[model samples]
Target: DLSINGMWTERLEDSCEKPDEHPTPLTKQQLEQLVRSLILVEQSQELRILAPEIKVLQEDLQLKKANVYRSIPYSRFGSNRDAHCYRKAFPYLLAFKVSCQEWGQVLLRRKEWDAVLEHSLMAWLYTSELPQWDTASHNALREQCYGVLAAHILTALQHCSLEPSRGHELLRRLKMAQLQSQSIVPCIQELQRILGWAQHLDCDL
Candidate 1:
């Protein structure tokens, strides 16, 4: 139990920090600017980050409107205010998709590929709750996912082949090469922990 607890604690330390993001309160002027800029601006890579953020912002904004309309007595705003807000947010949301396509070249760049892949996967996985990005984006999305998996598999073999000192050296190289990205080892360890828990429950069953 002591050893198990130690491993779990270490895993928590290794996991990525949750991003600190807040809703972008678009002013009337900002909204106009965004609409105008959408065409000529060329916002591909930015959309990779913005698409997810906008989804969350829209949801929050919808809830806020709902709270006001539902709570205000004798208000003409009606219970459907939230739905109306969502309609307004739709064009901007679709713009985000076009933006992603626009930035395809940036995403495909060798230096940014790893980060783009990881970011896109997170966007797709969380789409239901927020981004609402279309399933059509899955081709590039799956390619990046498979690329990461393949890289990890290769790393796993290299890790096993190395002496202890050489293994550490190889890991250092990966961290540098991958822009200080978190490693496959900790991710694998977390998977093992989850499987271990499932097995224990199965035995109990």
Candidate 2:
């Protein structure tokens, strides 16, 4: 965790030193990598370095939106709410996916069984949320996070990997990731398949 924090802090330093035409817009891959770093820091249950970084991201995104909406009449008309949503969603999504992945990490560290299954479900929900966004980066990140979390959940759950919270606690975490992706793990798919089979003959999750 110290290593993760140190690396990101260095990346954050490099990012600050660079003077691009605009703050270098974070690419899908970069944002995902950021989330991965956030996850590592969180799982270690150590320092709180991510908050300021998330603020930087939010401020940068807001700046971009202000610039974008100014020239684009259609956006000003509020007809492109999806565009607005997509712009802001990734931070929240990254936070969400990483946090869940962190939870799975903690459980794996603890060797908790049923709770791990629950955390696995939480990861599945995160991935499923990914496709709802129309952005191409989101689509790709969805697939990327989906694949990673699937393997993660499977390995952890093999058998501890699994599932979140009610609204307030969740909103707090979003504040933590500066706000934050989603896709199914096979066990979730398999669980659904089994549930479907059970409904065909009387069983459930």
Candidate 3:
């Protein structure tokens, strides 16, 4: 079924000439179906086989402009609403993000930077989707995740400066997060100073 979804994307891209003529929007059920498919696909140990499916889902997500991160669809889980509801309710989308983060840590432990960046970026995509921006716990998690994100960019910058492709990729994402997230992790100041060619760290001044 995901393969069918993949083929549909290829067909849609080839056939549609105008924005208005693009494929119909996926129904709520289809959205959930596709999101669930990706979550399961990424969980597999056989990433070699599942990689294409994840790529298809990512492409489909971009084409649709479908944001599973922001809105929580409560009707999807009527059987045990209370169980899923934490201080703020956790949606299927949050589960998808958390799943990505889990796999990302696994990749990080193996020092697979590209793979780590892919999943870490996916997980970072949803950090802005948390319901309460000013809440204490949310603020803490946001800072922590952004810190890790900066480390990813800085590490890439340190290693990939000569071949700057992936470093630039991480740099772009870092700027986006710096703008989008209301606060930055403190250590990111050092990164900014380096980028600015400053001679001294903030502590020295």
lDDT of 3 by residue, 1-205 (tens): 3321364334423332234664675454554455445555644534554333346444533322233322233556353223233222332333334344444544555556565555455545655544443335534545555555545544543433223454445545655666655343332443445455246444532
Q: What is the lDDT of residue 69 in candidate 3?
A: 28
lDDT for each residue of candidate 1 in 69-148, tens digit (9 for 90 to 100): 33323436554324444434433333333333323233444335433334433333322223222333422323333345
Best by lDDT: 2
Which residue segments of model 3 deviate by more than 4 Å?
1-88, 91-97, 133-162, 165-169, 182-205
Candidate 1, superposed: residue stretches over 4 Å from native: 1-83, 109-111, 131-205
Clashing pairs in 1: 44-103
**Candidate 2 Cα outliers beyond 4 Å, as residue runs:** 1-23, 46-81, 126-131, 135-137, 140-153, 160-185, 188-205
lDDT of 1 at 21: 34
Candidate 2, number of clashes: 21
Model 2 residue 30 CA deviation in Å:
3.2
Worst 10 residues of 2 by lDDT: 173-182
Report the lDDT tens digits of candidate 2 across residue range 61-133.
Answer: 3332233233222545444436565555545455455554565555556665545544554444444534354
TM-score list, all predictions: 0.27, 0.44, 0.44
Error at 124, model 3, angstroms: 2.1
- Candidate 3 lDDT score relative to the true structure: 0.44
lDDT of each: 0.35, 0.45, 0.44
